[model samples]
Target: MALIQGQSVDSAVRNALPPRNLGDAERLVSGALGAVVALWAIRRGGLAGGLATLAGAAMIARGTSGYCPVTETLSAKPAERQIARKQGWRSAAAAASSVTIAKPVEDVYRFFRDVANLPRFMRHVESVTVIDETRSHWVVRAPLGRTVEWDATITEDRPNERIGWRSDAGAQVRNIGWIEFRPAPGGRGTEVRAAIAYEPLAGQLGRLVAQLWGEEPGKQAHDDLRRLKQVLETGEVPTPALRRADADAAMPDAA
Candidate 1:
């Protein structure tokens, strides 16, 4: 009788957990593919790269664990477990990076605080229209020829040190981020560090947390700061369009 009860308990537990769906051969192949894609994505550096990294990580997890939450969710009956379907803020991708600017902390702080100036240096930012002292509307370029727009309001403000914001309701992409300006060592300049958490896509919440916070932040954030440095020190970025505009202005216009 005791042996039968133990067997029954084992069966119940097995039924409760998601099934190990992949065979050994399939798992090996999947893991290999994931490693390759992940390595390539890390080197690529950008939004596309970040997305690929997440995809690779999912594949790796599925291969090694042999348990796929996504597969489980699709096959799950109403009576089955609900944990596979649960998604929380922790699922959001997060990243951070820092750069030193050749400018005073207060000046760097002011530039970032004026959110409208973001488009001047932030590469993917199409525009930022100030709605009020603490609110703004942002339009940004997404992968493919797509654009995304959102309304956000500043959540925290410190005179010349830090600033933070969060997206408003019904945003296409939810965003929570902050920037800090600190004095650099040896009086060199200000050191700026930015950290952000956001749902990159509308519902891609199953991505791995480690991949989300990986090298992406350094690449994207450093690029933004590099452009900002050019703007702050030299007054403009030398992009192709700007170069053409500069060349034409010296020639002629129908004005």
Candidate 2:
């Protein structure tokens, strides 16, 4: 019987309205609380108690119907636009890092081009599965034991030069990134430049959570590049044990 603005009184049009944002868990919890309150009010057995019971019953109905008038009223267009802007800022976030490795450009390029090798130096990456010649599936570890997966297609590939990739549609975390290899001056080694842009799973909130846990993306990229350099230079990533051994060996023996 309710009429929507600029619309006819048809069931089909009414059904097409935006769905309630309340998740299943929220509905279940609200309904349970409302039922308990309603039972308590009924036990009081008076005129005021009757009004309280009706209110509680209304709450149960709202939860069951997946419609909260207060929530809908608060989620007006202006609030929606503000949320969109926040998410957009997060989606456009990016980080870049560069490192010079004591290895030839061809060798470095070949190592990176093989996506499977990424997990060796990328601490957050759990695995990278090659789907085909130009496609790969990546799984990265997230906070609280969560893992995010995405399929990426190679957008650009030039042997010993550069490679670029973008995630496919519906990816859990949308992303695009590129890596370039250049010969260092005097053929000393390869200079690798990498950049990535991604939309965090929970947008800015997710990023802030990561930063709070000392896992910002920029810091991760910097450390990953350092690990890559160490791997290429020494055929192994440097560990605390290695550093300790090196320091001990450098110290003169106490007489």
Candidate 3:
């Protein structure tokens, strides 16, 4: 019959198509759940139950094939799908932090304007290579000895006031941020406030995991600013060992 031939052709086409989405663990879980639901629906024995069973079977097929129709419909290309995922994460997990450095606004602004100086205080930054006046490449440490790299372009620059930047597309992690330097009251120093928002390599879930492990961006920013304060004040970052040695040396001899 024509109907039987059409069904055979459909089967052949389905088998020939490559998987469009769904990771391995997702496939396994979905397959197992679909199998259970299909059996349950078939046992119910009704018109609605029959439809449910069919739906469950379709889900199982999708899982077994590692394809997700919904995602496939949304994005035909793998690269676009990955980009969508990064954008989603970037929108979901945004964080900000600020600090006050005991230095003049001009001094602090100049220090930050030179992106190369970031690694001196930022623990995770591996390096920043300046490409031009407006563009630079950055490498930062990631979990498990991995690293993330991106090219960023300066968006806004105001002398001794603020600087803003955003990463270029296709970066390992999309990021946008700004830093503001304001003169402190009573001629004390500069109030240096830095804010950064980024999507981690694995998205929001990865950020959550990092936070649970005490490696969150907010924590890093705070620590980096603290180091920056130490650096600008003393021209060096004092380690705990160094502080302890200095304390011992300063103490008078006891009987």
**Whole-model Cα lDDT per candidate?**
0.77, 0.81, 0.81
* Number of the candidate with higher lDDT, 1 or 2: 2
Off by over 4 Å in 1: 1-25, 28-87, 202-218, 240-255
Error of 1 at 140 (Å): 0.8
**Angstrom error at residue 76, model 1:** 23
Relative to the unseen true structure, what is the C-alpha lDDT of residue 161 in candidate 1, on a scale of 0 to 100? Answer: 88
Q: Which candidate is the best by TM-score?
A: 3
Q: In model 1, which residue pairs have backbone atoms overlapping below 3 Å?
A: none
lDDT of 1: 0.77
Q: Estimate each model's TM-score.
A: 0.60, 0.61, 0.62
Put down candidate 3 lDDT per residue, 48-118, tens digits, no spaces.
Answer: 88998998898899888898866543332344345446656433344466777788888898988999998
Stretch of 10 with least lDDT, candidate 2:
73-82
**Candidates sorted on TM-score, descending:** 3, 2, 1
Q: List the residue pairs that clash in candidate 2.
A: none
